[model samples]
Target: MERLINIDNGGTLTDICVWDGEEFSFTKTLTTPFDLSQCLFDGMAKASTDIFGEEDLPRLLHSTRHIRYSTTQGTNALVERKGPQIGVLTDSPTLAEELRTGDASAELFDDLVGSRVAVIDADRDLEELSQDIVRQVNRLTTDGAARLVIAMADREKERTVKGVLLRKFPRHLLGSVPILFTWEFTPDAVRGRRVWSGIINSFLHPTMERFLYNAEHRLRDHKVKNPLLIYRNDGASSRVAKSVALKTYSSGPRGGLEGTKALSSAYGLEHVLMIDVGGTTTDVGSVKNSTISTDRRGSIRGVPVSFAMSNVHSSGVGGSSVIALRNGVITVGPESVGAAPGPACFGFGGKQATITDVNLLLGVLDPDTYLDGGFSLDAQRSRAVITEVIAGPLGISLEEALIRMEAAYFERMSTSFADDVVDAETTTVAAFGGAGPMSACGAARIAGVRRVLVPRMAAVFSAFGIGFSDIAQTYEANIAGLSANEFAATKTRLRERATRDMFQEGHEIGECRLEWSVVQEDAEGQLLSEDSYSESDPQPSASAHHAMLTLTARFELPHASIPQAEATEKSPAVSSSTRNVRSTAAQVDEVPVFDLDTQKAGAAGAGPAIVEGPYFTARVPQGWKFDVTVAGDLMLTDTIEN
Candidate 1:
């Protein structure tokens, strides 16, 4: 494999993993939310500096084969409702009503569409309907509609509306909004799903389009040979232009699952669970029998959307999540003070009490060495916030407040694994991300999980995972019948389209491994049967409820294998130091601090001990034992016999 760079952008930090062909190394940088491209380049500069002992972005980009990117920005935007105002134009009242059904849909609808929805009559005179559309478009836009979605079932009506909108609102017009038709995304017969696909894609489009294209153009200017490949939720990659926005949602977490799945296979783990704790949320997913769980009809933030999404659940609790007393009972987050003013300990004028402050105040994290000593954490700022927001209001001492805050924070994360991690007793928890290792043991124990694994590159594992993905393009067409003529025509069309897309990606049809799959979905959208046929095989018969037939063209890319750590027939490296940490308000103990980088094969130690990775930290509780795997990853097992 040529030199590869995989980037995972989180709300608090951006992780960069570089494969210099000889070895894999990673780095972390603070996220610049105002302009995501800034951090993208900054991380590259840092990686280049690490590789060459000085910053040289041009040389790094020129030598790179592919730069695959994934981010939690879409996930965070949806969670915070921090996207553009979208207006829906639907002629079907049933679909309109269905779009806003129940509490979850209702809440999302109010944010995405609200009163900006314009219901039109299909039977109205062409002139009158066009006039009404113009007025509605103007009204919706006048009332804060940044984008518009058309969700009409009839294709002809949709075309007519499209014609009317384009004529009335030209693309070149200064105030005209980009209009998306539901059919453009999918050919689903399900009314609400089609609309949701459009709504979500439209909602996530602007931010992704703006930042991704900006970064891609900047890379091009730097003489980078390849266009940016977006690591998607479905474990395939496409260039930014060819990628769909909704698929980018939760893509970061999906990358984590990929990394976890790879390590699970290496470790021979049967059932495994991944907890990727970033700044804004704790993304949890399960891997079983070498397969990463995914949903055909994916849910984003508990609201279903028409997409193939990896079954990763994101909770709004993390290291940067606010920890507060509501009615004297602790409550976790739905709101986060992201990178701009990260945690109070970051000392960027943030006053909110978070788990970062709690951990720092308790000395579980060393202020001086945090983030590879990127910057010093402010103990005073952390203490002030914890004392004011938690201790004073609850009438508790500083140490007691820290203890309570940390417990509440860990509990919130542990609860997320209730149903997410199946067979916790047998499952090995893969803990990663900036904050994942810190609470892995405590959270896993609470969730009844006894085994834990932390990658040596745990801090940047998601980016590392992106290296596992291959370039793939999938095309689907709703087949009208099983007649050979109809099937042939559809296959021809899909092949032609795929050929064009792959050509744009600088790959030819000959280079890609293609296969055809047929699926039959009933009236209720449940699958009846499915089968696959190769290019050489005869076409397989579809079931009576045949709905959509999909064709996948995959270009197999080279992947990096896990490195083998040389065995050492020696005792674990002794702790270079010890520090006093408060296990409780009244209890303080000096525990050994073992740096994973210095640990040897078969290195083993028991907690309460602090295990520090390059950019992350793990606090091994008293009952757990930390063992260094031959692969150099840390494995924390509960010695308490759960």
Candidate 2:
């Protein structure tokens, strides 16, 4: 059988999904921060064992047609301030002056400039500045900055400075530091953002390069003929050598959004809200009219970078979020325990009370069946931590404390959705991730969402999405003051570059799909419109000076055809047993629980029911009804009160 393997490495777990042309199987393993490849191989081996009843690594690797990988390592590294120290050199003295004058650009620059870095002024004559550049470079190196970035406001000056630096300090020489030119990556007018983008990419490059190359080498050694593809933040996959560090940021979350888009199209849902509740954070994104929303100017931890990526907003609300009472105010978290010392219940030396502990205390999670019985959870430890940490401080009973913690956690998520997501009432919530289904009902109720769709492979949904992605690349060019002819020429140039790159990656031009679009901005740099570029469009008048024009070219690589779900008769949905589930409606009742794998396609049920799958558990509250679709997706709808 033909096989496809896709994996998503998150903060706490690495999920692997395998498609063998006829059936899908998934497994998870704890993330090994020291060496990510260990978890990658472990998850793959575990899933292969489950599917084929053997643990043969070489056979699995050689037989797989495509293996795609995504991760949140870059995002975690950036948020934790665990990257290389960087020094910046810019020509504009206005950056410092603008800071005093409270300019927004300066504010952005301040956020991007981390500790252990210095910004030196290079806006002087070449002869004079050359000496100063060497001095500043030496100073930064002495201060422990291993990387340098040069960003001049004027593109010409930036290029000149880069050339002078390279001539003075040739990379071939020993002890020469690497330098990045801001304009080389993005030639936009916002010098601050451009500089920040280069800095972030430089910070992430070394680690990403090391791990990806190591994984690729291992794959080749295992006799895998095809190159390993890395998932991008743009919702596509590209060969490792052709991808930049910036494109890998938040890639795991983007995978979830991509999966939601596919599900929306398959179910004919026009509007959907995706909530990915992972170990460290909850990422929320949206799909409108079957199109995933994208942010041309993406940000990492609120630091804007010039990259077109899916619009995903994240909050520190997840299963591993630490719960506490600080200053008599109950707080859920902006802090997480992460993979190591995950939660008090994990028994990995964690002492803090987290949402996982709260769930275990309230019986929302089945301790005996956690991780499909792969690992056992200590419910007693969870209760002890919750009582000592939360109940003791608030002087409340254990049950009340659990209820309060649940309310606080859900409230934070609901408020975040209200602030960032649009039209929640009309949108169907597609909940995924290891912890998403557990909280979907309460979150949906608070967000005023009427429907929820949990995919059969919801636990590894991002990995499933990666399986459906195509090998693609996107290129952008700045066209601020170009006429119609100039714009057309730029588009053609970018297309040629994209086509050549894809060919080098072993994809034929004839078999590839190509698309082009023009992104236009107004005087203030706000996005005005993005439309497909056409040769028949009217020429722009000379008097009409457009602020900026961005040309984008997308090349789609050939991929295996995904099989459609076949029609099958619905059988009676059988409940394994009943469990006492606490509801957000302030009630505790015995809820009928159904196993997703054994449940038939025609199975239908009402609210106050629990659908337990291998990796996730969904709680249907008292006012909702659920029906299993022909495609095996669980569809939940709110019931009207009479």
| lDDT of every model, 2 decimals | 0.85, 0.77
| Runs of candidate 2 exceeding 4 Å displacement | 96-126, 174-176, 420-425, 482-492, 534-572, 582-588, 640-642
lDDT of 1 by residue, 1-642 (tens): 568899999889999999976688689899998888999999999999888999998888888899999987787688778889998887876665787888888899888888888888967888999999888788888889999999887777888898888787787772647889887678776777778888988999988888888988898788776889999999989999899999898899888999888887888788888889888888889889778988766877667777778988778887788887799887888578878798998989997978888888888899999999999999999888878888999898998888887888778888878676667677988999888999889988888889999999899999989989989888887774658877778788999988999888889988998978777778767667667766555555665553677888888888877754455574765787898889988999999999898888788989999998889999999999988887889989998876
Error at 487, model 2, angstroms = 5.5
Clashes of 2: 1
Tell me how many clashing residue pairs each candidate has.
0, 1
| Inter-residue clash pairs, candidate 2 | 570-602
Which whole-number lDDT from 0 to 100 does residue 597 have in model 1?
Answer: 88
Per-residue lDDT for 302 in model 1?
Answer: 67
Number of the top-ranking candidate, with TM-score as the measure: 1
Query: Root-mean-square deviation of each candidate, in angstroms?
Result: 2.4, 3.3
